[model samples]
Target: MNEIIPRYIYGFLNSGLLLIKYCRSCTVCSRLTRFPRYNDPKKLVETREGRCGEWANCFTLYCRAFGYESRLVAPYGVLTLILDFTDHVWTECYSQFLGRWMHLDPCEAIYDRPLLYEKGWNKKLNYAIAIAKDGVYDVTKRYTRKWHEVLSRRTMVTEPSLSSILTNITNETRRGFAPQLLSIIEARDIEENQQIERSLHSEDDESLSLPGRRSGNEQWRKSRSEIGSDNLSSSACPVRLCVDEHVTKIYNAFRPVLHQFIAEEVTKAEAVE
Candidate 1:
């Protein structure tokens, strides 16, 4: 239903298929944002273009404005070969379905697919944290394979030190709230942490599900690189570039699906595009 903002966020992502090319070009760098923040969804809606963080920030802002709770999440440590965890950002909105907050990546137009990185992309996950108005949340369990592997990353900060840091940051971030509510938020954070601890300790939660296909293959990675270069290859004749046959077909196939989803949602509200 339109009432669920996560769906709207997901739908908006699907509608804004601009993230596809953006990811290919800018995933390796944050510097691209400086050229233009792409921070305004209004502009992105009009232009139909933006990178991953732009998609995340815009979605976060839109969700908050539309009366839904939201947060921006980023992985904290270990973007190594084993972890293969890249520095990425996404929005998380409170979900009525799972009765807990869920992950929403606009870049991939994926909803509740934290495991997509570990399982689908066949990458490792370490520490991921969410920064929201109410409090800081450790949401790593939703993505990781080996809990023990993340222990060192978690140890980067002691419990007491991390608590103090989060408390101070929360006060600064959520200062507009009534002073009386700070303690309430703090209590909620503590409870959520305890819940996460129990959930992560469960035997079933230790390993992520494997991918059906052998993931992160060299050929697949190379194909993705070609996909990112806007399907055109740099040849000896720089001006005379050749387009990859597969990329055009794939993009054309996916483009219509993205447009249809966006159109359905737009019919319900004023559309920027």
Candidate 2:
């Protein structure tokens, strides 16, 4: 078992208090500007809202910043129950100890909800569960023509790049660390360290800028090359229109189970400590 997985889970679970405080107190907005069209990597970070509302992004970033392998999961839009909408994102961690994947609902934790199982889950949901249990779930019933379409939509869309993922992680970590570091410096009357901290933060801000970052561009180009020429035109793809439908199905199918798993894990961790 790789030592990092447990450490990430521990770090994530333990950082709940700090995460909440930062989310509440920070003035930064969380809206993504390059939404609706998930393909343009350039527009990804141009959000007016701070990072607080985007807890999944923050959590994924945190895990990656700590060197834990993580990925974002979303539902296919087809299975929403009445009055339920289905655009959501979550994080999954690759656990070496369990030799599988583990789902981490950072957004849910911030919002104070347990993970649950939704009916008619999509590939992401199934992937998340498989990680959680360290085994595959019965995805047979869930697979359908519509579900395949959902998978196709994801494949067609631009998947997040390693650089973007890392940048997000870096932003979240700096955000998480800044206030605490400031508080510590304030406590110790460490005047000299303040200057050093400012310089470090300035560097971080420049590095995180998406425009000049070669790594982000490289990743975007790499993804484009992998997708080949088929279905490059978003307008030609019916999968985009059907995405919401598939997402609804996934949410309805697995919400309950996910909620329970999160609750139990939190409880066990608390008891152990």
Candidate 3:
């Protein structure tokens, strides 16, 4: 399922099930562009608004609908491939077969392509932290090539303080959960943190990746050689027809089946889980 997921999810996001609409700027305002905000996942699942943050959150929820463990990531850093960092959101899902978290973007329909932002789009990422009902985890290496370059800027909070806050948040959020669920979450947080530690220690470059993931640098190099431009960028997503029109078709075609599935079994599945 992990190996073949790109076939289904790639088509789902890229084929237009979830659309992408640029915010005038982003979460933070620029001299030229205004700060952009987005709809919540539940609302976007129905509305299909297509903003980046909305796409990330809704996709995380969608993965959960399929019983995949997932998280919402907020990466605050440079997308300019330079010093100015901005606020952006994406998703990461645990791959049982791969034994690590893989990056996913419903906006670009990219999976495990952390370097796509930096190498493919020429961005410079400083910090990427994932937030969930379980806990928070630093997932910067999955998206950055220059940890040393950005370490000084990552001083927003100390690791100890951040960890404490995440644990408290998870506990507060899990108020109604049974002991079993709390235990499961605690184990999950530990596992995810271990992965983060490994990432921090890894000497791999953008051309290299974790055991179960593909190389974004390799993919970008291939795309450049084949297409002559970086198509992964939202502004330049390589697809036929206008992206909005293309996705509208996918949404119309898939929505009925999805709604039917939810009506029939999603509730039961959630209860069982």
Candidate 4:
């Protein structure tokens, strides 16, 4: 269901389908064009089209309906946009295969590309929060490699205060839930955060070479500074020699022990002689 839902949503929402932008009292309006953004899934089904906001909203609802644990991922603070309403929005469905939430953007028909916004589009993201059934999570770290830059941009609230706010919201949302369930959720959150840290620090060249935003027009993406740079070569990315480093560390740590063992063997030999 997780694999099928985004493609299912994307199947009908192609370029041919047009969103109603300008409709008059009983006819069509020509001068000004602005339509109320629909949040309800039922209304979205009727309209059959919208931007990222509507796409994410409907996709998340469908995922929940199909018994998949999912969440609507969106930015928390103010987003200064050249076009569109918010920075970007997408869905993250908990993947049984990986035992973690995977990014699923129906708009792009892209999955597991959490770095799309930051790396692909070349956008500076401040906060990316996941609004789940159990609670909300400040998942900004999962999406960006330049985490220090993202941190510097987060001037709206202090880290502790932001954490407090999210905790409060989550507690309120998780009210009446079993203590055991809450504990499980908290453990999952910690594990996920650790996983995100590992992923952000990953030295995978494939991740580093991910292309620019594939959904929007070239001009629009360029305007938003999202049209990511061309494929990065191995020379440019320079994969870290962690294996060599680890071996060297092990040798350094055990060198003294090896010398002591050799000295003990020689001393026993001298005594025997």
Candidate 5:
């Protein structure tokens, strides 16, 4: 079902679903755009179109209807707010075939491309949380390869606070779950945690040559700075010059001082020789 749903959605969407780009605009002027921002899956089915959020929402509903445990994956900014094209929404279905959660983007019709945002779109995500009926999880590690850099960017909350918050949210979400279901979910979570840990240690060869953001047009993707990187190695550690910033000035000043120190040291070495 996990493998079949993406292809089905891809074909269904390509057939006739109109992707309303203006739906993302300010809702205050929604009357001007006259776009129906439908939240209900039934409404989405009737309308048959929307952005990644809608696609993920409706697709997640479909996964649940088919008895597959699913999650809505939301990649957000450091403030935990969904920023406009910088952020994206997707679905993750717990695959019975693999006994693990698999990433699925109905918009792109791609499956298991967990690094699509980080590697494919060259996005530096701060948090990629997975929200399900039973729990909320900080699944940032699943989506990013540069854990150290990601940790550096997560400045909104401390590690313990973030973990506590997520745990509280999960407990609230699972409050209504029966003991049997809760136990099953706990076991699954443990398995997934181990899987994610292993994934962090393992190198993904496919990440070397991931394609760009295929869901949006060239112009749109370029506008969002998500056109993606063909040269993964070069783009991975982008060195940006912080012109006129305090740190930049300090770095610039240090360069010549370090150069002078090296010259003097070399001269002293020559004298010794």
Candidate 6:
């Protein structure tokens, strides 16, 4: 007997087929109703939970069922434009072909049609960009840094990882050690004050020189500047959430079934080949 493929991969393929089958003729609400496992909005204000929950359920079930680990990630601030809420959810999957995690957002892709891409539309608020012409095929770029680096920048620390001995050595190594150390300490204090000043005046004052918030009409100027200054390669910065440990567990648990499905599909294709 031939070895069998997993069900999870078939589920993944089936999910796209299902979306195409059900969503082609149906309105968004109608398609949403079909997935009763996902919560739906009673009103516009009640949309966040429903929207987030729906994405989470589809991502988790479809991807996991296909043997891919998936998880819902919440970005830093208000991300979705559709609802007036401050958050959104997207899916992450580990791609063996890519040798790393990748992101997908079927919901955003489905919703961000050219006819639907409004200024305040929920899809427009998302940080992730879509690839499909119909905006149904989703792919996110990689752009995440280690947590320590983020903390280091926020705290004004020269090195993110400093052992006690390393700190002492650095203190003793410099010429005019005492004055240099004092100056470094003073500069940090001034920077902190400036950061606080910028935060306090950020809403009304445009002239504040802050680390991340720029003084201008451009909303993304600060983020752009940070990205440029970091000298990070494109792959280093994840545009979407990559697989972390927790998500990996979910994927691993589902992989056997998913792989079997993919294998079966591949075998069928090879038979035709």
The global C-alpha lDDT for each of the candidates, from Candidate 1 onward, is: 0.54, 0.34, 0.58, 0.67, 0.68, 0.35
| Model 6: CA > 4 A from native | 1-49, 77-84, 110-273
- Candidate 1 local lDDT, residue 269: 33
Q: So what's the TM-score on candidate 6?
A: 0.26
lDDT (tens digit, per residue) of candidate 6 on 1-273: 011112111122322321111111233333322221222111111222234435455454455544564544444232232233333455655465654335555444321122121112212222332211111111221222122333333332233333343344444544365777668644643553454344333343334221211111122333233212222234663322343344447646755654565557544334333
Instruction: Give the true-structure RMSD of model 5.
Output: 23.3
Question: Comparing candidate 4 with candidate 6, which one achieves the higher lDDT?
Answer: 4
Q: Pick the candidate with the highest lDDT.
A: 5
lDDT of candidate 4 at residue 143, scale 0 to 100: 89
lDDT of 5 by residue, 1-273 (tens): 001111111112323443233332333443223244355654565565566777788778656654677889887642232224457889999889998999988766678988888888888878888988788898989988789999998997899999999999999988988999999989999999999988877887763666677555455677777777654235543222222154345535544543454456544334334
Estimate the lDDT of model 2. 0.34
Clashes of each: 0, 44, 4, 1, 0, 26
**How do the residues 1-273 of candidate 3 rate in per-residue lDDT, one tens digit apiece?**
001111111113422342222223322442232222234454465766443566677778767766788888877542221233234578889899997788886565567876666555545566777877566666776666566776767787886886687667766788888899888777866786787667667665645422211222344335433222433345454332355466578768866756666567566375336
Q: Give candidate 2 regions above 4 Å deviation.
A: 1-53, 78-85, 110-115, 119-273
Identify the candidate with maximal TM-score.
Answer: 5
Please give the range of 10 consecutive residues that has the lowest summed lDDT in model 4: 1-10
Model 1, residue 182: displacement in angstroms? 3.7
Backbone clashes in model 3, listed as residue pairs = 16-247, 77-85, 77-86, 78-85
The model with the greater TM-score, 3 or 5, is 5
Q: Give the C-alpha miss distance for residue 153 in model 1, angstroms.
A: 3.8
Candidate 1 residues 1-273, lDDT tens each? 001111111113433432112112233443222123334455554454444565577667556545567898877632221232235678888775565677777555567766666555544456677878666766787666457776665767786787688778766788788767867666666666775677566555335442222212235445433112122233453221222244246545655544554557643234223
State the displacement of the C-alpha of residue 65, model 5, in Å, after optimal TM-score superposition: 1.5
Which whole-number lDDT from 0 to 100 does residue 21 have in model 1? 22
What TM-score should be assigned to candidate 4?
Answer: 0.68
| List of clashing residue pairs for candidate 1 | none
TM value for model 5: 0.69
